[model samples]
Target: MNILIFGYGNPGRGDDALGPELVAAIQAENIPGIECQDDMQLQVEHVTDLTGRDAILFIDADASCVAPFHFSEISAEKDDSYTSHAMTPHALLHAFHTVYGKDAPPAFLMRIRGYQFELGEALSSDASENLEAASLFIRNLCKSPYAESWRSLHRG
Candidate 1:
């Protein structure tokens, strides 16, 4: 299955870099059937990139997530202002649905716990540990033939 992964966060900040760090690890492997992309944040145009993928994965650092990493399914939800600078996973899904007249691919969001996001800071040791754990989890998923099992198991 074709899997599209968008990992977005400010790498300049401390733990906020977890998203892009995970993407870097995944991309370094050069796995097939998986396309990994990174950005400072999600944008309107990114919805279009979701087209034709069997599934999509959105990765970000979440200060509030209790687990090392939490996975949740993404459902389309329209935003009042489409012109906003940044968009959430659900809002992006809504945009894709509106543009294509159909639900976007089965999408999941992986939020890795983050403690800090200070400017010009390197990752904290704790966040680095979490990043390692999250990276291994995602790498295993990418190695799988299909992401359907993960979707079914972690639907939210």
Candidate 2:
């Protein structure tokens, strides 16, 4: 797998549902070979998925961060204490790095802005809206270089 876009969140919570919801939206795009998962707790065993991938985009909801968006490659040596979510991508990266040494593929992190993580029946208005944006972003990342251009199709 060249790209693994992992999204994690609690579906019952308002804005926290962004991760799982984004997965569903991106699925309809039908980007071949792009693997998507909606997970609550990340495990070290999942690191095996990074073997031959060129890039990985990991996303989740942020509960305590000021900004709504950030795109960056996570550092191998960085501790995940600063992460806004309860689960940490850094830990996964670290485990992969340790197990595979330099062979592990590079991983990038993306996050959606969410103010409300409260238990609810549906997503909040703002969060529901951002789910569309987040899904579009994932689609752009998954489209292969040799595939037909579809990024232009997504507007706003």
Candidate 3:
């Protein structure tokens, strides 16, 4: 199945690098039928990247999420972020539907637990471990790119 793995975050900020870091790792695997993209943050323009994909997965670091990580399917919904420079995954999906006149491909989110988001700081040891766990889980997900397979593995 075709899939897009989109990760967004500021790499210079400590744990905020989780998203881009994970995207880089997955890109290195060179899996077929998977397209990977990373950016400092999500934006309305990102909706263009959602076209012609069977499924999409968004990854980011979340300070408030449970340790290690949290995963769940996300639906499209217009929100406050829609008017801002930085948009949420849901906002991006909403934009996709608005622009394309059709619902976006099934989407899921993985929020890797993070701490220490200070500028210029390296990833914390705990966050590094969490990244490892998330990486392993993503490798498995890539093995079965179907939405049904992903939903069954949801943690949220």
Candidate 2 clashes between residue pairs 3 or more apart in a chain or in different chains: none
Candidate 3 Cα errors over 4 Å, as ranges: none
- Best-first order by lDDT: 3, 1, 2
Ranking of models by TM-score? 3, 1, 2
RMSD (Cα, Å) for all candidates, in order, is 1.7, 4.9, 0.7
TM-score per prediction, in order, is 0.93, 0.77, 0.98
Off by over 4 Å in 1: none
What is the C-alpha lDDT profile of model 2 across 32-58, one tens digit per residue? 777777687566667787677766767
Clashes counted in candidate 2 amount to: 0
Candidate 1 has its poorest 10 consecutive residues by lDDT at 147-156
Cα error, residue 64 of model 3, in Å, equals: 0.3
Tens-digit lDDT track of model 3 for 69-144: 9999999999999999999999999999999999999999999999999999999999999999999999999999
lDDT scores of the candidates, listed in order? 0.85, 0.66, 0.95
Q: How does model 2 score by TM-score?
A: 0.77
Tell me, by TM-score, which candidate is best. Answer: 3
What residue pairs are clashing in model 1? none
Give the higher-lDDT candidate: 2 or 3: 3
lDDT of 1 at 31: 86
Q: After superposition, how far is residue 34 of candidate 2 from its true place, in Å?
A: 1.0
Of the pair 1 and 3, which is ahead by TM-score?
A: 3
Clashes of each: 0, 0, 0
